[model samples]
Target chain A: MKAETRRLTRKSDHTRQRILDAAASTLANRGYAGTSIKAIADSIDMQDASLYYHFESKDALVLEVLRTGVVLSEEAVNAAVSALGEQPDPIDALRAAIVAHAEAVLGMGDYPRANVRNFGQLPQEIVSAQMSHQRRYGKVWRNLIEAAMASGRLRQDMNTRAMRMLILGALNWAPEWYKPRGELSPGDVGRQMAAMIIEGLLATGAAQPVRRQKQGNGR
Target chain B: MKAETRRLTRKSDHTRQRILDAAASTLANRGYAGTSIKAIADSIDMQDASLYYHFESKDALVLEVLRTGVVLSEEAVNAAVSALGEQPDPIDALRAAIVAHAEAVLGMGDYPRANVRNFGQLPQEIVSAQMSHQRRYGKVWRNLIEAAMASGRLRQDMNTRAMRMLILGALNWAPEWYKPRGELSPGDVGRQMAAMIIEGLLATGAAQPVRRQKQGNGR
Candidate 1:
C-alpha cells in the first residue's frame, strides 16, 4: 500500500510539472491577454477539461507559473547567501547577492516580464503571497547591506532601502535590452552591474586626497 | 492670400493633433496588438475612412503617434542640455538632465509605455528615426561622463559606456513602478536616482580609502 501511494505521488508531481511548463511557454508566446486555457491544454495534449481538473481557472494556472518562477529566484538567493557564508568580508556578501539576482532573472528570461505584465491581474491572495516572497528575497540584500555598513565596508549614511531599489530596478529591467547573442553574457553583465554600483566611476585614489584635508585640519 | 494660407495650415495642424491624441488613447487602452484603425477613428468620432485622410494606414497612424512622442521627448532633452550650457561639472549637468527627463515622461504619462510597447510594430524607418533621436539624447549623458573623467570629478579608469547604460537604465525604467500619487514626485525620484548613481552607496570618504589599491581593476 505504501509503495502504491509513493508511485501515485510521483505521477502527480510529473503531471504538475508538465502543466507548469506548458503554462510558461504559453504565457511567453501569447502574453497575458492572448493566452487561453484551451491553448495551454492543447500544448500538453490534454483535453481542455483536464486542465480545469488540475487548475481552477486560467488565473490559477498563471499563479502556479508565477509561484514556480518566484521559488526558483528565492532558491538562487539562498544559494548565493550560503556560498558567501565562507567569506568574512561584507562587501563580498553584497557582491554575491547582486550577482545571484542577475543570474536568476536572466535564467528565467520571459518569466520576469510575464510577472510584471500580469501583476495587476493577479488575485489579491496570490499577489499577497508573491509580495511576501519578494519581501523575503529583499531581506537577503538588506542583511548584506546592513552587514557591510556595520563593518564599515559601506557608508552608514547610505540609504539601504533606496540603494536596494536602484539595484533591483536595474537588474529587473535588464531582460528588455539584454540579448544572449550580444557580446556580453548575462553573467558578465551581472558582474559589471555589481562593480559599477560598488566602486562607481570615481578613481580609487581620488577621494583619498579629500579625506586627508579633514585629518590635516584636525591636526 | 496670407490669411487663407494661415487658416489652411492651422486647420491641418489641428487635425493632425486630433488624430495623434486619438491614437495615443487607443494604443494605451487596447494595447498595440489589439488596437485598430476603426477603433482610433471611433474614439475621435470619425469614420474609419476619414482616418486615412490624415494617415496612410493603421501603421502610419501608430508611427505618427510615436513620432510625436519622440519629438516631444527630444525637445525636452534639448531644453535640459541647453540649460546646462557651458557647465563644467558633469555631475551637475547629469542631475539637471535627469530632472528634465523625468518631468517630460511624467507629464506624458502613458505615452511612453505605448511608445515602448509599439516600438517593434513600427515601420523600420520610423524606428530608425526614433532611435536617432534617442542616440542624440543619450549623447548629453555620455558627454557629461566624458567631461567628468576629463576633469578630476570622476575616475578616469571607469567604464563610461557601462556607467551611462547603468544610469540611463535606472532612469528610463522608472515609469514602470513609479506612481505620481506617491509621496515622491517624479522630479524627486529623478534627483534620488542621480544621487544613487553619482554619490553611490558608500560614504564619499569611505570609497576613496580603498581606491589607491584598486586603480585599473576593471571587472
Candidate 2:
C-alpha cells in the first residue's frame, strides 16, 4: 500500500475514535432521545456532514457506542473471572464478576456508563441492532450463575434467572448513585453488593427470615 | 356550599386527574426528554392550552408525577413494615419493605414506574423540585437499615448507605425488565430479591466468600 493511503487510513481511524468518544459522553449525560448527531458533532467541532461521512446514521453511531459498552463490560467480567485461575470457587468467580461489572459501569469510562444510563430509553431499531452483543454478554453472566448453582453453593430453591437479573440490576444501577469523588469506590460498592447478595446481611447462624410458602423453582 | 359550586369543583378535580394519568403513562414510556405536554394532551385528547391550564408548565407536571411516585413507594413500604406488627425482626421488616417497593414500582401503576424510568435523565430544576420527596423516601430506608444494624443481626462492617442504595437500586430497576405476563408476579420478584439480599445465596454454614482486607466501614 502507498504511504499516503496508510496515513489517510490512520487519520480516518482517529476521526472515528473521536466521534465515538463524543457520542459516549453525550449519550451518558443526555440519554437517547436527548442526544442527537448534530449535538455530538457540535461537541467535537465537526461538521454534521463530516460526522455522517464516518457513520451512516445516528442509530448506527449510537449503536456502536452502546455495543462498545457491552464489549468492555463483558471483557472486564471475563477477565476478572479468569484471573481466579482454573477451578476457582464458583462463589468467588461470581464475586469477581460482580465487582468487575460494577467497576466497568461505574468507573471504566463513559461508554459502559452511557449504556447503563440510556439502555431503557433507546429506540426499537437500535435495541434490535444491539441485541446480539447484549445476548452474548448475558450469556457470560448466565454461565457464571449456572456454575455457581451447579456447585450447590447457591440455594437450589431460587430461580437462577431472577438471581442474575437482580445482581446485574443492582450493579448497573451503581452509576445512578456512584459519585466519582464519593466516599466509596466502585469496587467498594461492588463488594458491598456481593456481601449482601451472596453472603447476605444476616449474621452467621441467624434464623432464616420468614418466607412465604415455598414454591417450586419455576425451572 | 351551593350544589352547583360543589359540582364544578368535582368536574375540575376529574379533569386534573385525567391530565395526571396521561402524564404518568407518557412519562413511563417516553422518558423525560421524550415526554411533552402536547404529547400528553394528545394522548388524552385534550387541547395543549387545556393541559397548561391544569399543569402551568412541563416541569410542574413532571415534578408532580415523580413526587407521586415517591409517595406511593413510601406508602407501600410503610404499610408493609407496619403489617409486621410491633417489634418485628429487623430482617423481616427489611424484607417486607423490599417486596412492597417492588410491587409498587412494578405492579401498582405507572406513577412510581415513571419516576424509576426517567429519574436520571430529568432536568436540574425538576430533579430539585423532586428532591424533598426523594429524601423523605430515602429516610424510610435509612431508618430500616439502622434498626437492622442496631439489632446486631446485620454485618456491622457493611456500609448502610450502600446497602440501602443497592437494595432500592435493584428494586427500582425492576420496571426495565419486568414482564406482566411473565411467571413471576411483582411480589415474587420482591420475595426472591429479599431472600437473596437478606438470607444470602450461601448454603447454610458455607465459608465466607473471599474479600479484600477488612477496612472499617466508611461511616
Candidate 3:
C-alpha cells in the first residue's frame, strides 16, 4: 500500500510539472491575450479537454504560473539569506541576497516576463496569494535593513520601509532593461545597486582621500 | 490663403486630440487587448468608420496613444529643465527635474500604464519611434548627472549611466505602486528617492564617529 501511494504521488507531481511548463512557455510566447486554452493544449500535444482537466480555466493556468514563479523567487532569496547565516556584516549579506535574487529571475528569462505581463490577468485570489509572498519577500529585506541598522554600519535616520521599497523597485524592475550580454553581469549590477544605496553618492567621512579632497575643494 | 491653411491645421489637430483622449481612457480602463477601434469611436460618439478614417487600425490608434504620451512626457521634462534655468546647484536642478518627471507621468496616470502595458503590441516602426523619444528622455537625466559631476556634488567614481538608470528606474516605474493617497506625495517620493541616491544612507562623516566611539568603549 505504501509503495503504491508513493508511485501515485510521483505521477501526480510529474503531470502537474508538465502542465506548468507548457503554460509558462505558451504564456511567454503568445502573451496572456494572444494565448488560449487550445494553443496551450496544442503546444503540449494534449487535447483542450485534457488541459481543462488539469486547470479549470485559462485564468487558473495563469494563476498557477504566477504562483510557481513567486515560489521559485522566494526559494532563491531564502537560500541566499541562509548562506549568509550569522554574518556580522549585514550589508554584505544584503548584497549577496540582491545578486542571488537577480540571477534567479534573469535565469528564468521569458518566464519572468510572462509573469509580469500577465500580472493583471491573474484572478483576485491569485493576486492576493502573490502579494502575500511579496510581503514575505519584503520582510527578508526589512530584516536585513534592521540588522544593518543595529550594527551601526548603516544610518539611523534612514526609513527602512522606504529603503526596502526603493531597493526592491530597482531590483524587481531590472530585468526589463538588464541584458545578460551587457558589460555588467547580474552580480555586477546587483553590487553597484547595493553600493549606490548602501554607501550612497555623497562622500561620507569614510570616502577615499581623493574623493574627500574633491569635496573639500568644492566646499 | 495662410488663414485657410491655419484653419485646416487647427481642425486636424482637434481631431487628433480627440482620438488621443479617447484612446487613453479606453486603453487605461479596458487594457490594450480589451480595447477596440469601435469602442474608441463610440467613446467620441463617432462611427467606427470615422475612427478608421483617422487611424489606420487598432494598432495605429494605440501607437498614437503611446506617441502622444511620450511627447507630453518630453514636453513636461523640457519645461521643468527650462524652469531651472541657470541654477547654480545642479543637485537642486536634478531633483526638480526628477520631481517634475514623476509628477508628469503620475498626472498622465492611465496613459503611461497603457504605454507600458501595450509596448509589445506596437508596430515595429512605432516601437522604434517611441524608443527614440525614450532616448531623448534619458538625456535629461544624463545631462543632470554630468552637471552634478562637474559641480562636485556627486562622487566622481559613480557611473553616470548606471545612476541614470537607477533614478529613472525608480521614477519611471512609480505608477506601478505609487498612490496619491499614500504617505508620500509624488513630489515627496521623488525628493526622498533623490535624497537617498544622492545623499546616501549615512550622515556625512558619521561612520567614523560611530566607529571611534565603539573603539573607545572597548579600550
Distance from true location, Cα of A16 in model 2, Å:
2.3
Model 1's CAPRI class is incorrect
Residue-wise C-alpha lDDT for candidate 1, range A44-116, written one tens digit per residue: 8989877765666777778768776666766776787787667657777777777777777665655554554
Which ten contiguous residues of candidate 1 chain A have the minimum total lDDT?
A210-219
User: In model 1, which residue pairs have backbone atoms overlapping below 3 Å?
Assistant: A203-B155, A204-B211
Candidate 3 docking classification: acceptable
lDDT of 2 at B50: 77
For model 2, residues B1-219, the per-residue Cα lDDT tens digits are: 432345345557788888988899988988888887889989889888877666667888888889998999899899999999999999889989998898898887889989998878887888888889999999999999999999998877777888888788888888888887777778777887888787787776543332222222110
Native contacts retained, all candidates in order: 0.34, 0.64, 0.38
The global Cα lDDT (0 to 1) of model 3 is: 0.65
Per-candidate Cα RMSD to the true structure, in Å, reads: 10.5, 9.4, 9.8
How many clashing residue pairs, candidate 3? 0
lDDT of 2 by residue, A123-207 (tens): 7888898999999999999999999999998887777887898898888888888886766667767777877788788776543
Top candidate, metric TM-score: 2
**What is the DockQ score of candidate 3, to 2 decimals?**
0.25
Q: 1 or 3, which is superior by lDDT?
A: 3
Deviation from native of the Cα of residue B159 in model 3, angstroms: 3.6
For model 1, the superposed segments whose C-alpha errors exceed 4 Å read A1-19, A25-30, A34-56, A86-90, A116-132, A138-160, A206-219, B1-59, B116-159, B206-219
